[model samples]
Target: MGEVKDVPLLSELLKDSPKNWGKWGADDEVGSLNYLTSLEVIRGVGMVRSGKVFTLQVPMGAPEGDPIWPGRRTAQRVNVMDHSHYQCGKGPHFPGELHYADDMMIMYLQGSTQYDALGHVWYDDQIYNGFEAETTTGGMTKASVLPIAEKGVVGRGVLIDMARYRLKNVLDRGETFDHEDLMAAAAQQGVEIKKHDILIIRTGFIGSFYTMPSDNFYDNFVEPGLTYSPELVSWFKDMEIPNLVTDTIANEVTIDPVSGIALPLHSALMRNLGVAFTEITILDELADDCAADGQWAFLYVAAPLKVVGGSGAPVNPVVIK
Candidate 1:
């Protein structure tokens, strides 16, 4: 429903206008933070203003590995035992040992490279934007992401069903996704993206993970895959998106048709800019509802384990309409 502008002409965007040698300067415009979004591709149209919060979490099973999109691993059945218990018959076989069975896992939170709350990941031994790392710890032990309590999370949420649009020949899922794709989807549904809004995408890849857990788990090449371009990243960063989420196993597209690498979105967002990502959500029900209601956006909330100094934490996000 929106206009296409020749794949955003990465060469130009990298330059300035993203085509004709940029706008006014730098031939090497690697990161200037200019942004643009059109409401042409409307998604989560109705849910954006919903009163209740939406849920976006999937049930946990045994730890599983995605043959495709390997940016993050999955929870599957595993042998867990708390070392503190009488394993070999002792006063204390092991302290802080495993207890919960495969029944629950702490893998979905910040999504793999999980988030280390302001209490975690410190810059120059400092936490968050300016909190000193020493202040977070007792006796100068210096805390990491572990101490992150539940209060650290709680915010508004929005979702875009990019996958659904493609199926109706509305959004282009066959081609690489760019910033405009988001706009186009929004416009088609008559929705607008606002500031500080957490954007979620449903790429249709969630099916295999849901319907055929065994096959989707083992097969490397499957349909409903999702991906994002650097242009999209620029837009989100410029928009200052606090959190990003997806219904698929991997937040980013698995295969890089151009570079043949895995997780271009994840690499660019995480290792590159440190944007928070959420994955493995049970969006099928939501997707179905979105299709029927023609609304995509919804209020979302997810709380992940406050693991310390860890790469990621496990979370169960909920989206409400």
Candidate 2:
């Protein structure tokens, strides 16, 4: 696409989009996640059959470095104390001569595979649940990741492997898909995406990031993902989806080809409908297994770190089959 100024504003594009604000109550922070009631938890647990488990987080500080959004740096792990300190006789002393290494990591809250708080993005000066955008000025005070972390996300997760469905190892950059494509992929996998299902879509985008040249991966800076449409947004609301997990930087196409707008779904579905977003997940292993066994539905469980007043939090979603 061209410069962002050439595109329609998100507020204009999503002005007619549906919203679930105040549906859960005025004090609500987590939006569509409210759909994951106890019954939804039980429905997720019932998807477990083979006892196989998959962790959907990529390495945080890999040798090749973690993948992050543009303009954000990779995680930097610093060793505050190590055996070298003891060797140099400058380490802290203990009564029993105990030795230990301590370290800390500096990274964006959304740098790793993570869940975005409902208040992470907004237009019109309002976030999910009508929280004022100013509430996120210094750090999120309302609708922060803390609330979502405390609530937790547990539900049946249905995997829709769009790459496999389309007979490709990975979709082309800037490519877009929608709810109709998702339904078609689910049908191809012989699974039904039910209400309150934690929808996980795989385009093989994030997986390819590791092997391809970083420059090439980010050259055009657009990601292949679901695009914005009123019908797509309505489908999410009508289906009562609780969360959307994907192996991409952003869950939606970076820029809408039609309106020339950028990540309009961030405004339509997340900011408006209050649907949670899980991004940059590692789904190759899970996608491979699902393709092999033809089992696409599973119990999905994830608990983001309880970072008080955070816009987003890192997470390692667990999937059980």
TM of each candidate vs. truth: 0.59, 0.98
Clashes (candidate 1): 49
| lDDT (10s digit) by residue, model 2, range 235-308 | 99999998999999899898888998878888888889999999999999999999899899999999999999
Q: Which 10 successive residues of model 1 have the least lDDT summed?
A: 28-37
Could you give candidate 1's per-residue lDDT for residues 9-124 as a string of tens digits? 32232232112112313221111111112221133233455455445555555345432234545544444444433455443323675343223354434443233332333234
Over all chains combined, what TM-score does candidate 1 have? 0.59
Best by lDDT: 2
lDDT of each: 0.49, 0.92
